[model samples]
Target: MKTIYALLGASLLSACSVPLIQPNATQAVASHYGTSAPQGGAALDVNWWSRMGDAQLTQLLALARTNSPDLRSAAASVMAARAQSGQTGANLYPSLTGSASATISDSPTTPRSDSNTALVDSKWELDIFGKVQNAAKADTARAGAEELAYAGSYVSLAAEVADGYVGYRACRLAQAEYQNALASQQDTVTATGSLVDAGLSASADLSLARANVANAEISVTNQRADCKVAAQSLARIVGVSQSEIDAVISKGGGLPKTKPFQVASVPADMLRQRPDVLEAEKRFAAALLDMKVAEAQLFPSLTLNGSITASDPRSWSFGPALSLPILDGGASRAGVRLANANALTAAESYRAATLTAVSEVEGALTRLAAARSNLASAQSLVANYQAYFDTVDRDWKVGAASLLDREEARRQLQSARITRISQSEAVLVQWIALYKAIGGGWVAPKVVISKDLAPKKIEG
Candidate 1:
């Protein structure tokens, strides 16, 4: 008993010093994005999409999270991976089984004979070299990676939902703009026709006015069609029927107000924020453990097997079993090579994902800044053109300006308004892109335990 206790204590002491295989390559990332802006200490929102202040958007996001088939599929994948991890964890513990049997024989000239046997057996593959331990940890890492995958899906879903909502709203606003222009152009056509009939305007001028009215009608038709498509897209994303989406959109007024864009940090923060990058890290970690498992297979293994029976003459046995690799040809060597290559692949994948994340953040930031600047300039231009149109309209009412001058000013004002609307939508799209680039508010796995990833004593 004393020797056993002493060995247990020694095992406990040495467990802390056990070594593990991990990703060896260092990740050197820049401190700031290429397009650095004003930095704040605010952390990214976990529910960033909801900050748009549109209640319907919030509701749609909630419904999509609950009802979307993509999320459901991802959830199922996580469950399956966790179940597999549990199965692998069983290798860390001893397995016990029992068997019972009864047999009887009878013949015409021989007396009947019966025998009964019952036995309880147990087998434990001692984790001296951490083969089972490494395998268990590898499975744990895989399960964690699957969880991260689910988070990535969630981020993508929310981004798409926001995009559809923004587009639908833009289309609605554009349709309104076209309707206003159509009203104005139709009035111009009526006034021009009256002037042509009175010999006050040329027939060519009246024809041009009619053409403008026709073009205005076509613009309204195209705008309405775009709105329908955007609505359908939102419906598909919400996993609801078109009618339901229509009802939801009917209550929606405009794009949710978002606080002006700011980031706490760039590349440094993205490494922790990006779900895909963290997922790649988990995969690489799992692959490294797999390589360790394969390397351990090259060594001998120790197992404890015990059996006891209850019968007329009771019997029991207990002993240690050892398995040594003998002549497996080149399979074991090839397995090691394969594992090594897979680990290398995982490492490269992680690196590539990191680089991609960096590039996306930089590009999104640049586009966002440009879009904002363009929208500001567009709004200013709209203001100036609208003032010019109002002045010409006043001048025409007093017969101080030609009807052609008023019409030209009106067209310029409408065109400027259209451009401003387009720039506004562009800014919103860029905002979504930036949100997605920053990892969509995903948190990495915090605390997880694999049965064992290092050499440890197996309980007897």
Candidate 2:
């Protein structure tokens, strides 16, 4: 027994002694907006959708939050992880259970008699080597990972809803442009036909005008179809009936406008705020803990177990129990190696995730910059084209120019307007990308959950 205890103690100490690997030497990417990341801005509110200042979008987001299956699954996962953590943590303390028994016996020549017994039993494992402590830590880390995962899912879902809404709005705007273009083209076709009848234009010119009108009609058809598809997608996201979506569509509104958002300057600390990155880090930490646990198993285990029982002929008694491993080939050592390898794999995965996050942020920044530039150019072109169209319309009204000149000016104006609207939508989509790249609003809610909620036993 003494030898067993000594061996167990030695094993526990060795297992607990394994050092935690430090985070790799890779430098964190800096924020691109400034020389340094902001000390603090607005606290990342959970209702980030409302910040966009669109009541309709807010309503849609609310509906999505309630009905999104992904969010539901993530929530369920959090609950499961919490329950698992609680169960593992409970092992660190004494467990008390109530037991009751009734027995009847009959002697060969005597009447039968019954005995009833009821008692509470308590057992505690003395975690002398920190085995249970390590297990508890692993479970806690896992639970934290699950929580981050939930936040990630929520952010992702929100972003998706935003993107889908923006897409629908863009489609609507495009459809409107096509419809307006078709009307203008139809007028041009009519004017060309009148000119041809009056011997002012050739038949070929009329044919060209008719072709333009046909092309415009085709574009309108395609745009309408696209709008319908977008509406269907939005309906699926909000989990509403198609008719309900159509009703929402009946309320005319322009596509969401983009607002200037302050970008972070430094790139290095940006990853720290991303929930997915944080989750990966936590998982890596847990994996390291698991590796330590496996290493601990290489050595013998010392268990201090005691039980007290009262029998018909004996009273309650208690004593310590111990276990030792003499030999099991190289199974224990091999387990340690396996665990170490897993830890290494987890570390690599964490590094990969971090790198990927940086790349995504950088890409989003690039896209946003491009979109901004395009929008500015498009806005300028629209202004210029609008002036040109007004001038040409005035000239043609007084017979200063041919009707074809006015028609061309109108076409140019419509094209410029459509381009501007498309660019504006692009900017909005880019902003969404930026929001997602910056990890959406994951930090605040997670902090709140961790700080306010006490770890409780989760019923599976």
Candidate 3:
């Protein structure tokens, strides 16, 4: 017993003697987003899609939140990770098991005999070298990473729904413009036919006018088809019926107008909002803990086991079991090397994710700025063309302009209107991209281990 006590004391001392080889790498990032916008504006809302002020869009996003298969899978992954963490944590505490058995025997030489026994057994591993503790911490960190991944899925789903709605609305707006152009062309064709019948215009002019009307009609038909396809695509994302999607979007709302929100000026501050970046960091932290577990494996392990049996007379036994690495070749050392290499890889991955997060934010900011500028120019172009078309139409009615000139002016006006519509949607799509690039205002959850073994987030 004294020798066992001496071995336990030596094992405890050796636990502290294991050398730690933790290698954590920090990455440098840009200071700003390369924008002049001031930092002080309304903070981004968690439900950023609501800022679009479109009820139909909000409804679609709500449906996607509840019905998206990606989210369901992510939620299941989080549950599995949490369960694994709890399982790992269980090793930190003592375990108890109970068993009962009964036997009856009849022999010619010894008459009849009956025996019954109930046994209680327990085992506790003493984590003197931090192996079990580090393993539990590693699994807990992995659980935290999975939770972040679920949040990432949530942000991605919202972005997808918002982008789909915007696409459908943009297609509808184009269809409307094409229909208006078709009506105008048909009227021109009717006027040209009258002139041809009066022998005042060439029949070739009438033929060209009829052809223009036919082309315009085809344009309208094609635009309508495109709009239907866009709506169907949206329906698939929101997991709703096509008729329901058509009913909601057919209410004739043009492109959604978004309420502007300011982005954080500092890149590091903004990166905190990104779930992928945080998830990568959590994985790195978990890898570091795993390396510690491997390092602890090089030391001795100590476990206490006890058992009690109730039979003809009650009996109990208790003892400490020490397992020293007498000769396992180099498996434990190889494990340590493998874990250290994984930790290094995780650190590099975290750095790469950080760089990607910053680049996405910067790219979104650049595109949004350019879209806003282009939309302004497109609006001016449409206004100027509309004025020219109106002047030409009045002159043609007064016999001061040819029908050909008025028709050309009208075509130019229609083209300008289409450009404006496309640019308008471009601006809105860029806004959605910006929102997603900034993580849609998802805050990193602070995981708090609760009594029920469920991962809970602490309220800020």
Expressed as tens digits, the lDDT of each residue in 270-293 for candidate 3 is 889999999999999999999889
Candidate 1: where are CA atoms >4 Å away? 1-24, 40-43, 100-117, 310-313, 391-409, 445-460
- Indicate the residue-level lDDT of 439 in model 2: 81
- Candidate 3 lDDT at 41 equals 45
TM-score for all models, in order of appearance: 0.84, 0.82, 0.88
Q: What is the total number of backbone clashes in candidate 2?
A: 12
What lDDT does each candidate get?
0.79, 0.73, 0.83
Query: What digit string (tens of lDDT, one per residue) describes model 2 on residues 29-99?
Result: 54464222223335444545676677778777777666667766677778778889999999988887767
* Leading candidate by lDDT: 3
Where model 3 places Cα greater than 4 Å from the true spot, the runs are: 1-22, 38-41, 104-113, 395-405, 445-459
TM-score of 2: 0.82
What's the C-alpha lDDT at position 105 in model 1?
91
Q: How far does residue 280 in candidate 2 sit from its true spot (Å)?
A: 1.8
Give candidate 2's whole-model lDDT.
Answer: 0.73
